[model samples]
Target: PIPGWTLERLHKGYGQALQETEVFYDSQTDHQRLRVFDNPRFGRVMTLDGVVQVTEADNFIYHEMLTHVPILAHGAARRVLIVGGGDGGMAREALRHASAEEVTMVEIDAGVVEFCKTYLPGISQGAFDDPRLNLVIDDGAAFMRNTQKKYDVIVIDSTDPVGPGEVLFTDSFYGHAKRALTEGGILVTQNGVPFVQGEELTNSMRAFKALFADWGCYLATVPTYAGGPMAFGWGTDGPGRAVTLAELEARAAAAGLSTEYYTPEVHKAAFALPGYVRRLM
Candidate 1:
């Protein structure tokens, strides 16, 4: 607390005390029109895809794991639906499976999609240019209700239950998602970190369980997100739906996806819950 020392210098020195970070790049997406920022340590950083999404440092691991695991578990998946993945990164992974014939992406915000396509090319890469991807700028719930066709897998890659995505976590939405899937189809949604928000996780799981025959709440580590640990809920209408790492790895090998974070060894490990977490269910 010196007279001449500015607050900016104090903050900068405090940050340097723990770690000095810099924003290498940032821009506004032309699609859904959200801001995208990237730093050196946290790769492919913040993306406000309609609701200040992905502020954490390590977004890739969480994004990749959430979209891929269920698709792999379904095994014979061909057509897929990704709700709220405006960055198109999920579409990139969805099409990685040779069995995946088509991927329909439904994003509520067109501005976010456009901005990512133009600015955050590192995450989406050349995904938008791919012929297999059909990008729709619309409400995912409405899209699910209107489509007559069914999909092998449905992934809910949305932000927290607030603003544009509040409806996504509702019971009715889960019921709608159930109808959008084929018989024995698998559904996965991004829940928040259970450790930080235990009640939210429990409530969301209870809602999904009411609509499905079986459910699994698993954990993943993403340094960029809040709490550094995140959770995902896999809801299915059949018992014994959990896929072991051995199974997922064999499938990944056949498909030939050189993934950075997801591996068969990590798959089983991810689902292994701690004692307190087991108590919550």
Candidate 2:
């Protein structure tokens, strides 16, 4: 362990610490305590209320899987909705697809967006300035509950199911998200690491199972997110999950995506959950 490492005590009796080489911003936002710092291995790191949110390195795994899987599977998702993700990473990836004509992101904390844009510009990569992105600084749950607008894909790039993010994991929120989707649309959420936060995945899966015809989760390994592989909840009323490998290959080719982590094969294999993670769902 490093002598002056910042400890993140997200779970009881377990924690992850990183040595901060340079602290850029550490202050309380209107919603939570937000911090941005640089680590030797992880590059720039951002945390919300003491929990790791995104790192300069390895955010590609989480952001790519969360956004591309649904968009590629849907094949023609013109309008996408992102709940939370004030850092703009989700919007960044979602807008990569030319098929996504409009990407609407609702974030509760404007401070998070501003701080990340300044401190972690590489993560969002100029997605905030894109004409296709409509950024809304508001409570994500409230927006979902009232929005009459429909999306072909909805990505819940939220924090863990705690504090302000707690409302986003409720049955009511999932119900609203389902209603906000177009026919055959897909919804994905951040369900945490199943090894430690098993209950979180199970609870979200339960809500999804009740609301959608198909519900499950996919795995992605984010080194900053400790314990084990993190799970992203998947739910939709259509055949998105059953997209053939050849079709996915064709779509990937068509999109002309230059990615570091995402591929059609990996996307398919991510859903092949291990027994321990499967048990959680």
Candidate 3:
């Protein structure tokens, strides 16, 4: 907030962002505008290109759901790849899986990595310093296309499909991502909230359909994001990627993952999308 001015997200046609807040830091990186603020309900909030990326209070819901759903379902994901999650939340969660021996994260902008590490350290939980993480400062789309290294699980923790993040949502990127994965590997992406951006989920599923034999999406309620439930795009060549609750619970227990938002039950329930969201598929 400056003088009488306030930053707000129109959220497509959903209406105004409801949080009343105070700006802590705001600047324009080489790629997009970044803003860090404090919301009374959500605590610390990070926004890029005028979109809320994460809030300290509700971030676990988004991070855990996006990371664990695929990792746990795959049950033997050792090598993981994360694209665009410069904040490090995805890496933090992925490392919690005992099966993960190495995690390679490719982020285009070094500024986002440093900014979040300095200002939003809680979000990453020092995952940047973990010996197992390989942090690369390079374009994510290009890295996926060129890397000879394959991953057992790949998570695309990208911002909304705008500004620098738009390329990640394209079919070409999805194709390259599929090639970057090992056999039976799983890929998950942050498709926007279907309540407001139904087309985002629809388009992502369309791309997944062209690339993977089996693909679907799941939902998680992140209070930081307005409109409604956020959809996470899922894709895999493995037809048996979706396992029963009993199988997931056993895998999670074996992994010794202690999480607030993601449990075996929640993992099973997250895929039970509402009718309106299912229509997008």
Please tell me which predicted candidate would have the highest lDDT against the true structure.
2
Which window of 10 residues has the lowest lDDT sum in candidate 3?
A: 1-10
Q: Residue 202: error of model 3 in Å?
A: 1.2
- Report the poorest 10 consecutive residues by lDDT, candidate 1: 9-18
lDDT of 1 by residue, 167-251 (tens): 8888888888989988888888888667665665787788887888888677887654445367888888843256766778788
Query: Which lDDT tens digits does candidate 3 get at residues 176-213?
Result: 99999899999999998898888889999999999999
Local distance difference test, candidate 1: 0.71
Where is model 2 poorest over a 10-residue stretch in terms of lDDT? 1-10
Per model, state how many residue pairs clash.
17, 0, 0
Flag regions of model 1 displaced more than 4 Å.
1-33, 49-52, 55-57
Task: Look at candidate 3 and give me any clashing residue pairs.
Answer: none
Clashes of 3: 0
